[model samples]
Target: MSERTYHHGDLRRAVLTAALDVIRTDGPSALSLRDLARRAGVSHAAPAHHFKDRSGLLTAIATEGYDLLAATLADAPDLRERGVHYVRFAVGHPAHFQVMFQPDLYRPDDPELLAAKARATEELRAGVADRTPAEDAGLMGIAAWSIAHGFATLLLSHNLDRPVGDRDAEEVFRALTGVTFRTQPAGSRVGDDTMQE
Candidate 1:
């Protein structure tokens, strides 16, 4: 797809997708507007016009990530299910997941960024509404998000560094989450004895 073939919205979307592809393959530090333009088959200036600078592009990506995460978590039936969805989203979109948490990489005060973040937080909170007292919702949200985020981070970094016998990483993760949330373990306790390096 050449620049001429791209309309307004299409061009922006194409550029973003190209950036995502670059991040997925080479990591975010390897991204550049010029490289994204090359990948999108657009002029180098095209991405600059839309995103202004690296921070602007990252802000857009981060906001889009939050929106996507919010949508995915919304489909879950409860807090635990939402936690699963959160990890799945992070594992699937490691590019976005990496960028979304690095506030210094983008305009954290940007209205779009703030709104998207709020929506994602609200969705996460709703999942645990009945389980948490109203006054403690914020802390519970933080704890829940932390657990999911930590698990996803470990998974992505290959830091589990352990053998899981016959179980896959996802199965072990579900078991760990079950223990954290005080739910019945999907199989047995996912301790060092059950799955260790």
Candidate 2:
């Protein structure tokens, strides 16, 4: 069968989507602009019209990832659920997750990237707004991010396969979040009431 043709307006998205697939299967180090163009069935320079270079394409992918994460967080009911979804997204979309946080590899300052990052941060903060105190908001946000990010990192690095029930990542995340909140210091910004048993 012949390769499908992407219309002009959608070629950029198609290229990015194909690039993500490449990264997911082959790792970041294996990504190449020419390869992505080939996979997308477009001219080698087609991606340049939308993304000036490899960094530009990577930045666009990261921006798209952030936007997706922000939407997932927004759909969650509470901070805990939001955190769970965040971790889930990371594990489920390893390629996007890998690129989104690597500032050195992508141009974080790119307009699309900056906006998406800001929106995602806002979404997380909004999820915690009602449940956490003003002073604790920042800490709570960072803590939630850390919990998910750390868990994802651990799982990705294969360090989470210990005898603790050979716990699945989601279970480990929930357990860690529970334990951390329960053992928080008295003066800790996050109150015990916010934690689920």
Candidate 3:
């Protein structure tokens, strides 16, 4: 592979990092390969060489986000912890979180993206494992993911009317999850807390 190819390690990471910064500051719709290239101090064509196009870039971001999500959820002690982890992941990595769920912005057919998403799904499911009966395990997993995703999205969008003064979203999420954990049958709900661990 040429130095310009993605396997170059540092360059690709630099570009991705720059892309994340762009997304965080101006939102995903504002992201452009040209802007990312400039931010990374690479040639205008560099990002294209790695990501192919804007969709490819977003796909790569989503893929990375999924892997991170899986890792974040892997060690949660319980369903409540999982929910806290999920919320924290979203708030901590808002830029990647913003693009990961937007199918219209990324290539869903990408192999890496598919694999990453599968891993994330598996991690989420593991949280509810053995807690619910096998027959309803799938439904429990879905419920857990739905609640965590909904809460995280609402928090990120500022749709949650709660005052967050001097406190991060993760703090609010942990409290909310601690109480909300009972809403499910002791087997559902995932949360992400950046402030904790």
Q: Against the true structure, whose lDDT is highest?
A: 1
What tens digits encode model 1's per-residue C-alpha lDDT throughout 67-113? 99999999989888888899889878899998999998889999999
Q: After superposition, how far is residue 24 of candidate 3 from its true place, in Å?
A: 1.0
TM-scores for candidates 1 onward, in order: 0.85, 0.81, 0.82
Ranking by TM-score: 1, 3, 2
Tell me the spans in candidate 1 whose CA falls farther than 4 Å from its real position: 1-9, 161-170, 183-190, 193-196
Cα lDDT listed for each candidate: 0.83, 0.80, 0.83
Query: Which candidate gets the maximum TM-score versus the true structure?
Result: 1
Which is the winner by TM-score between candidate 1 and candidate 2?
1
Per-residue alpha-carbon lDDT of candidate 3 for residues 1-197, written as tens digits (9 for 90 to 100): 33544554577788889989988888988998888887777778888877899998899999999999999999788877898899889988999999999989999999999999999988888878859899999999888888789888887787664455467667776786666655666555454442333
For residues 97-195, write the lDDT of model 2, one tens digit per residue: 988888888887888788999999998898878799999989888878887788787777656555234557677677767877786667766434332
Show how many residue pairs clash in every candidate, following the order shown: 0, 0, 14
Report the Cα lDDT for residue 105, model 3. 93
- For model 3, the stretches where C-alpha displacement exceeds 4 angstroms are 1-9, 161-168, 181-197
Compared with the true structure, model 2 gives a TM-score of 0.81
